[model samples]
Every structure is written in C-alpha cells, then in structure tokens.
Target: MLDVLRVTFPFFALVLCGYLAARWRLLPLEAIGGLNAFVLYFALPAMLYEFGAGTPLGQMLDPVAFTVYLACALLMVAGTVRFSLNERIRWNDAAFGALVAAFPNTGFMGVPLLVALLGATAAGPAILTILIDLVITSSLCIALSRLDGADEHGASAAARKALRGMALNPMPWSIALGALSSGLGVRPIQPVMATISLLAAAASPVALFTIGSVLARSQIVAAAAEHGPMPARDFVPVAVAKLLVHPLLVLAAGQAAIALGLPLDRFTLSVMVLVAALPSASNVSLLAERFEADNGRIARIILLTTAAAFLTFSAAVALVGPRG
Candidate 1:
C-alpha cells in the first residue's frame, strides 16, 4: 500500500499544488491556457514521437490491442448515446454526454502518468487510444451533434471538420512521423533528440498541474449550485459509465482478445484498462460548451470522475501491478 502511494502520491500532489495555486491566486487562472498549449502542442507530441521513434514498429502498431480497445470504446459510446436518446435528452446533448462517457483523458493525464507507472513502452497503447478517441469517438459525437440540429452544416461537413481538426492536431502527426522514423531505421540527430527529451520530461508535472488548475477554475461546486441540484437521473449514469463501465468494458475486451489468442500481453492489457479508467477529458466539457450542449452537466461529470479516479486508479494499479 505504501509502495502504491509512493508512486501515486506525487501525481496527485502536483495536481493539488496546482489546485492550491489557483485557489490562492499564486498562479493566475489566465496562465493556464499558455501552460496547456505548451503541453498539448509541444511537450506531449514530442514525448509520444520519441516513444514511437524508439519503439519497434510492430509494438507501436499493436493491431490486436488497438482493435480491442477501439471496439470497447465504440460500444460504450453507442450504449451511452442510445440510453440518452431513450431518456429524451436532446441529440446534441446526448452526443456530448456520450463523449463524456467514452473519451478518456489519455493525453494530458494518461500519457505521462502511465509512462511513469508502466514505463515508456506504455506510450504505444496510450498514444493509440488517444488517436482512437480523437479520430473516431470525437467524430461520431460531432456527427451526432449535427444530427441533433446543433450545426447548420450537414454530416459530410461535420466529418470534414472533424478530419480537418484531426489533421491540424500535432499529436497524431508526431506519432506518425515517429513511427515512420522507426520503420525506416532513421534516428533524430543527437541535438534534436536531446531537445525532445527535455520537452518530454516537462510533460508529466506540467500536465498534472494544469489538470488541477483547470479543475480549480471549473468551480464545480458553484456550477452545480447555480444550476441547482444536478439531475441525478441524467448525471449519475454518465459518471458511472465513464469511471466504472468504461474500464470494465476494456478489461472484458482485453480478456476476450487474450482468450482468442490475440497477441495482447498482460502489461499492455493493464495499460489499456488503466487508460480507460481515467476520468473524462476536461475538453469534453469545453466541447459541450462550444456546441451549446449541457456544459454544466459535463463539467460536474468531469469533476466527480476526476475526484473519484485517485482511489479507482490506485486500486487498479495495485490489482494489475506494473509491467515487469
């Protein structure tokens, strides 16, 4: 237990530090955007690129693991969307809800934390999951949102927008380039590799702090209060789907893959489960707000899941242990 805490405590502590800094005005809220940009646009991509560039191409493109993970995520998204529709939730709001239920915070928190917990090799699966969510899950949600009359554009336009957004995202491109380098057996020059290492090193602490700062700025309690009591009927299910159901599905899928003799290994399976167990990405709420969905509800879901994740993640790590 102490061993587990030793590993998990620093991650949460950095988050707490950020939360306190924001609460005490030690780090002004406005600074968060710049910090986030640094992580998203620079640090994270470099970290992933290095991982991909250095890892064997086969490991980087573990098709069995990627397929299983994607299947589980799609199932969760479909189930959530269906349930929301049955409950008479607006389609656009339901789409965003589905996103909250399915999209894990793989980039900001998952990548760095898993790298720490499972080592650099975990980066392959982590990056794969991120690409899956960004490219597939997000596109599905955007299409649904459009169907719900949220957009003036049609489905084709929604897809084009999604594709364009993904193309513009540096993470996927970095992963691709890194994989290309690995495949071609080309390594970055020493100076460039050193620079990449420096940026990658900053990813974990800065990203964790940024998460806490964002949480502090969210003022979840105030949002809940102003919105009145959250409709338990609506909120509880989404939170459960994200924090509990999502991980279970991933675990089930991985187990099934192994039983069927897929090349999935225990450590990669554990990494997939842990990543699935992460709270909904903070950006889900932002997406909701942008699309004029139920942003308050999404915000509360992010808060609840994130708060609960410490225990859930710690328990998961203890049960799964780390990759040998």
Candidate 2:
C-alpha cells in the first residue's frame, strides 16, 4: 500500500496544485481553456503518437480487451441513466450524468498515469480505452440525451456532429499515424522526433495539473451561480458509480471474457479496470453546460469522484496494480 501511494501520490498532488492555483487565482479561470488546449492538442497527442508508433498495433487494439471494456462501459451508461434520472425524467441531465459516470478521464490522466504504474507496455490498453470512451461512450450518451425530445433530426444531427468531432480529434489520428509509421519501419528526422519527445514528456504532469485547474474552475463558477442546491440523491450515486461501480464492473466483465476463452490478457484487463476507475472527465461539465443540462450536478460528480480517487485509486492500484 505504501508503495502504491508512492507511485500515485505525485499525480494527485499535481491535481492539488492545479486546484490551489485556480482557487488562489494563480491560474485564472479563463486561462484554464488554454491550458486544457495545450494538453489536448499538443502534449497528449504527441505522447499518443509516440506510444502508437512504438507499440505493436495488434497489442494496442486487442479485440478482446476492447470488447470487454466497451461492454462494461455501456453497462455503466445504462445503469447510471437508470439510477440518476429525476422524477421529471430529464433525459438531458440523466444522459450527461451517465456520461460523467461512464467516461473516465482517460485522455488527460489515464494514459500517462497507467503507464507510470504499469509500464510502457501498458500504453496500448490505456490508449485503447481512449478510443472506446471518446468515440463510443461519448457519442452514445450524447445520442441518448436527445431521445426525450423525440427529435429524430436532432439525434441524426448529433450523431453526425459526434462523428465529425471524432474525425477531427488528433489523438486517434496520432495513434493511427503512429501505427502506420511503425508498420512501415519509418523514422522521422531526429529534430522532429526530438520535438515530439519534449511535448510527450510534458504530457503527464501538465495534463494532471490541468484536471485540477478545471475542477477548481468548475467549483468556483458553479458556486457563483444560483444553480440550486444539488440533489445528493441524483449526483452522489453517479459519483459512486464512476469511482466504485464502474471498475468492479470491468473486473467482472474481464473475468467473464477470460472464462469464455477470449484472448483478453491480464495486463490489458488491469489497465482497463484502472481506466474505468478514473474520475469523471472534467470536460463533461462543459458539455453539460453547452447542451443546457445541469452543469452543477455534473461538476459535483466530477469533483466528488476526483477528490475520492486519490484514496480509492491508490487502493485499487495497491490491490491490483502491476506490483501485485
């Protein structure tokens, strides 16, 4: 346990620093977007490209791992939606809540953290979860949010928009291009690779810090507004779902897959479980606000899961990490 804490402590401490920076106005709220942009567009993509370029494509996109992880993710979506829906049956809040629960912060946090705890080899499954959550889990929840409106056109448009967003996402493209480069035995000029190496190195600590800054921004903004008192009944369950239920679901699902004679490797399964254990994606608050959902509740869930994850995630790693 102490060993696990040593591995996990610095990661969460960066988060704490970001939170304090935002709370103390060391990092302005508006500047949070630029910080996040630097991570998403630059550091993270560079890291993904490097990982994809070096890793065997087959090992990264294992069908068994993908299937088990996706199945558990969908189950999380359905369960969260069913549990968190209000008496008004607002599909928008319910759907976004489900998304917050189902979608881990895989991009910003999981890829680098998992690799640190596991190994460079763990990068494949970590990136694979990004594809599952970014492309599949996010799109499905967005679509589900439209169901209550019965606007077939809206749903179709949302689907198109989701696909378009995926098309434009640099992470998946980086992975693909990296894999292709690896397949061809091609190497970039040392200067270009050196630039990528610099950015990739910045990814872990910066991304983790950005998560705290975003969380702090959300908390301050939500407090400033009259978003009404959060219904603990509504949001607390979703947080629990993300932190506790989701990882356990993945564990069971992975075991089941293995029992069924699938090729889901233990290392990939462990990575999937840890990814599932991640706190809610911070961007869900932004998405909820955009869609006119209850951003306050969404933010609360993210905050709750993140604060708790320092302990819970460490325990999870202690129990099931590579060292185990």
Candidate 3:
C-alpha cells in the first residue's frame, strides 16, 4: 500500500542511490570501506548506546524474546549445516553456509529500518538480536568450521579467535555501558548527549547508503559466471531459509512464548519478525572469502536475497500493521 511505500521508500531509495553512485563511479569503491568503518565503529554504537541509556533495563533484557530469537537462529544454522553435509560439502564450507542462512543483517539494515518503521523502542530487541548473532551464532559457526578440520588444538584456537573478535567488537561494550548508565540512573552531560544524538541520527542514512555501495561493488554477476552454473539446488534453499523461514520461526516462537505467559507485546513481536526477515549480513561473503570457503556462492546468495528483501520486507510490514 502507499502507506507502506511512504515508510519504506527512503530506505530502499538510499540503497539504490548508493548502488547507482558506485556503478556510475560517482563514489569510488574504496571510499565505501571508510563509510562502513564509520558506521560500525562510530555511528551505530552511539545510536545503540543512546537507545540503551534511555530505555528501562528490564525492557531491554526481555528474556523470552532473546531466547526465542537465539533458538531460531541456532536451529537455522544446524539445519543448513546438515543440508550442506548431505550435499557433500566440506564441513568448513558447510559451516559458512550455515552462517549465511542464519545471520541476519541486523546491524546495517535491521536496526535503522526497524527503528524507522517502528520506533526507538524497537531498537532494544534489535540490539538483543545483534548481540545474539555476534556472540552465540558466530562463535558456534566458527567452532563447527574448525572442529572437523583439526585436532583439539585447532578447536581451541578457533574458540579463542572467535572470543577475541567478539571482545574487540564495540557494539557489545556500548550496549553494556548504556545499560549500566541506565541501571545506575547516570545521565550524560547535555553536550555529550547532544553529540551522541547527532551521531545516532546519521546511522540510518549512511549505513543504508554504504550497504548499497557494497552491493554495487560486490560484482555478483561476475562472481556467478566465474563460479560456473548457479548451484540452484543448494543456493535456492539457503536463500529461502534466510529470507522466509527465519522470520516465520521468529513469529512462531513469539506466539509460543506468549502462550506460555511470557511478556512479549505485539510491537516487540513485530520488530523481532521484521529483523529476522532481513537478508543475510554482507559480512558472510567476507567470512567465506577469509576461510576460503564458497565465496562466490555466498556472494551470489547475498545479492539475490538482498534484492528480493525489498518486496518481502514491505509485505511483512504491511501484514504486521506497523503499530510498533
């Protein structure tokens, strides 16, 4: 409906603008890294911190929502890994494939998009999902990828690496600091809050634009050609898992939680479903390339799912009735 379009157009349009800018060489490809760094390191954390500091700690730590979202993600990862094994893929590659299917783009796309469609309150669950993906889901994938390849030492090393990476990530720390401040009722000086507000305001548009630029530079067509004929049998299912199954699972989980007398409201439930419905993170392709897994396959999957998400997300929001 036009109402949905009015809510959703700017997000996709910003992406299209970034894509066209990159395609036309209006913005150099190298510049996207800087933009991404700005989003990841500075803007997003500030936004999350602001949200966390302002929200009630109890609301921020919704146990039922966290458990359901994480359980669904783990289920998808396990299911996809099994499917990959059945298809004769290596364990490492299969693990990466599982990640592609399970990891939603909660940071760049989900947070801004949901907050815009819903409200600042939506950021709480969105941040919770982000933390779950970064800590539990990613570490599990890394462990699985290494488990079959090496002995005990390799598994330890992989675990250590995952932990180290998680430690270095700024989002968790920002969230923690914000939660601490909120719990202690510690308010920032007006000037500091003002600065954070400014940075937080920039997170959505810049992050969306950077995503578009990344897509333009992904060279998905070239990767598909070089990788040979589409692995339709494998790729189609993973894409479906990411775009469709994940959200449905979240919705079902939420309903189950409410049935059990958990305190999930409609708006929060809608936000969780919307966040789950997002495409796989672009970083999944990077992880594939890093581990020398099926990078081309993953890249193509990202491209297809991201393109398809526009309609799917719009439909989801329409159906969910945007009351959040």
How many residue pairs clash (N, CA or C atoms closer than 3 angstroms) in each of the candidate models, in the order given? 0, 0, 0
Global fold similarity of model 1 (TM-score): 0.92
Estimate TM-scores for all models: 0.92, 0.96, 0.92
Ranking by TM-score: 2, 3, 1
Model 3's lDDT to the true fold?
0.82
lDDT (0-100) at residue 9 of candidate 3?
A: 82
* Highest lDDT scorer: 2
Per-residue lDDT over 45-120 for candidate 2, one digit per residue giving the tens place of the 0 to 100 score: 9999998888888877688888888898899999888877767548888999999999999888887888888888
| Full candidate order by lDDT, most accurate first | 2, 3, 1
Candidate 2 error regions (>4 Å): none
Worst 10 residues of 2 by lDDT: 222-231
lDDT of 1 by residue, 1-324 (tens): 567768878887887888789878898878877887898899988888888898788876788988998898889888998888755577777888899899988888888788777788888788789889998999888877778554577666877877887888898899999899989999889999899999988888888898888777666433654646657877778888898899889998888888988889888889889898888897676667666777777777777788788888787777775542
- For candidate 1, the 10 contiguous residues with the lowest summed lDDT are 219-228
The collision pairs in model 2 are: none
